[model samples]
Target chain A: MTVAAQSEVQVDNAEVRVTEWRLPPGAATGPHRHGMDYVIVPVADGEMTIVAPDGARAKAQLKTGKSYFRKAGVEHDVLNETATEIVFLEVELKV
Target chain B: MTVAAQSEVQVDNAEVRVTEWRLPPGAATGPHRHGMDYVIVPVADGEMTIVAPDGARAKAQLKTGKSYFRKAGVEHDVLNETATEIVFLEVELKV
Candidate 1:
């Protein structure tokens, strides 16, 4: 069994829900789907392994302080394959 | 005269807009209003000086990797009063 990443809800309000996710080496977020539009802000430069529902896998390179936005209905399992810990903040829009 | 902070638009889509703001010492974002609900992810531990329209000033403490959300229609000028530069990612949700 793979170790799951740790997530903490930093803020939840009418506007948005912000969650901080910390992934140790070899940790994964497991398969999940996003219910709302979201933005991701990486805390450091790292790479993430994205596994799609159809078993397709891809590598995503994240830059520190860089943010990206995505629409709703994204399904994937994010894994940290690096030796260093990876941290990021996910902001979900509550519209 | 206060130096203006540098802003780079990272992403813009139907759901959200992501911008990275960099503030050097004594720099400010100038007076601006947020039209959409937003979240801010700090790049490092620092303090920001928020100046309201009426000249009221307040200090906002920011922790690295921590994110906070706010509603729309907020008006303020954000400044970096520390010696080191401060950086953050702002995600605006277009509802």
Candidate 2:
């Protein structure tokens, strides 16, 4: 499958990793599992499709300025569902 | 001194604490030390003033969608310098 999003590492320290992700329409983060706890801050309002490892699917609404968090071990592929670009600031706890 | 901003806890887990911060003109987060490492995602374009623990001060420009991070033990009071409101998604690593 074609890659959907691009993530640029903004900061990497002993405590956490901050990545700025940009996803165009139909782009995706591919399949991956969270190695550690993480927080996501949406930079733009949009919709996303989540394809889970167990074949489950869901839709998530991305609201600008709002944030969410989840523990590690979750596995899913995140895809952009809107026509415009979507951006997010993802902070992964390393400690 | 009166507070310049308000923070609502969006998510708190074993690994991180996510706070949604809202700062109005002349609002401040008060003086405090970061007990843990943290990342900040700006929700709006604005300017801010940072008052250090030692009475030192500095100016910061907040651009919408941009993010930043810092290690633990940093002490500063964050104050909004613009006439408008400034918002941020702050994720503090706990683990």
Candidate 3:
């Protein structure tokens, strides 16, 4: 599929979709892709690994109240390195 | 109105809307309010004025690639202090 199915809701004229996937400790989202630009933010505070398309990756301890941006066609993956559930907020631009 | 009319575009399983309003130099968004949480980011780099509901205000020279988040029900206004258009991106949580 070009894109995976997501859950969304409407806010006024704007629509916000949230993808909440559970991952075990030391689990990963594996290699995936997107069709549009997206913003990555963690809902549940934890440590994560973001693997870039160029085989480069970075480890980030995500904060619950902070957010970062991602561009379109930027391939990446994430991993939960903590012993608890790692809930991340991925807000992709639905355009 | 509970919420104002807005324009939206859909991405793959996500949506991203570009609210490109041309503001005159020193123009403001007025004393407006919001229902949900929101993230504030500028698309076009320029000067802006953000006035909070508490009668306090601050002048922010916005960057095109940075973003900030605001909680729900925070009343604020923005102004463009530049001769050119001051474009900004506001992504509100739909839930």
Candidate 4:
């Protein structure tokens, strides 16, 4: 079984919720679906393996200080396959 | 006159707008107001001088990889007072 990644809720208010995720090598966030629109801010340069619900797989390259956004209802499992730990912040819009 | 900081839009979609901000020493973002709720993810440890419209000043300390959120209607001018360039991502939620 893959090790579970660590997630910490940094902030949650009326307008937004921010969570920080730390993924060690071989760690995974397990399959999940986003309930709200979200933005991802990568803390370091790294890559993640994205596994879709249908078993499709893809690689996501993340650069330090870069951010991206996605709409709600996306389902996937994120895995850290690199030797180094990967850290990122997920900002969920509550509006 | 304080030099103006640089802002680059990284992503703009129906749900969110992501911008990367770079502030060199003594650069400022000029006084502005936030229209949407937002989250800021710092790329490096640094300090910023915040100047309000009334000239009130405050200091904001930022940590690398850490994030914070604010509601809309926040108005201030952000300045980089350190010698090193400071970088961060501003994720605005378009609810």
Which candidate achieves the best TM-score against the true structure? 4
**Best-fitting candidate, scored by lDDT:** 4
lDDT by residue (B70-91, candidate 4, tens digit) is 8889999899888988889988
Provide per-model DockQ scores.
Answer: 0.87, 0.78, 0.04, 0.83
**Model 2 misplaced stretches (Cα beyond 4 Å):** A1-3, B1-3
Task: Compute the DockQ of candidate 1.
Answer: 0.87
- Candidate 2 lDDT over A1-95, as tens digits, reads 55559989988877778898999987999999999878889999988899998879899999997888887898999988779788888888887
B1-95 per-residue lDDT for model 1 (tens digits):
68789999999888888898999999988889999888889998889999999999999898899888787899998999899888888888887
RMSD of 1: 1.4
Q: Is candidate 3 or candidate 4 better by DockQ?
A: 4
Query: In candidate 1, what are the lDDT values of residues A1-95, reduced to their tens digit?
Result: 68789999999988788999989999999999999888889998889999999999999998888887788899999999988888888888887
Estimate, for each residue in A44-68, the C-alpha lDDT of model 4 and write its tens digit. 8899999999999999998988888
- Among residues 3 or more apart in sequence or in different chains, the pairs in candidate 1 whose N, CA or C atoms overlap within 3 Å are none
Candidate scoring better on TM-score of 1 and 4: 4
lDDT of 1: 0.89
As for lDDT, the candidate ahead, 1 or 3, is 1
Misplaced by over 4 Å in model 1 are none
Clashing pairs for model 3 are: A94-B10, A94-B11, A94-B14, A94-B15, A94-B16, A95-B10, A95-B11
How would the docking of model 2 be graded?
Answer: medium
- Between which residue pairs do clashes occur in model 4? none
Structure candidate 2, residue pairs in collision: A4-A27, A4-A28, B4-B27, B4-B28
Q: List where candidate 3 sits over 4 angstroms from the true fold.
A: A1-16, B1-90, B93-95
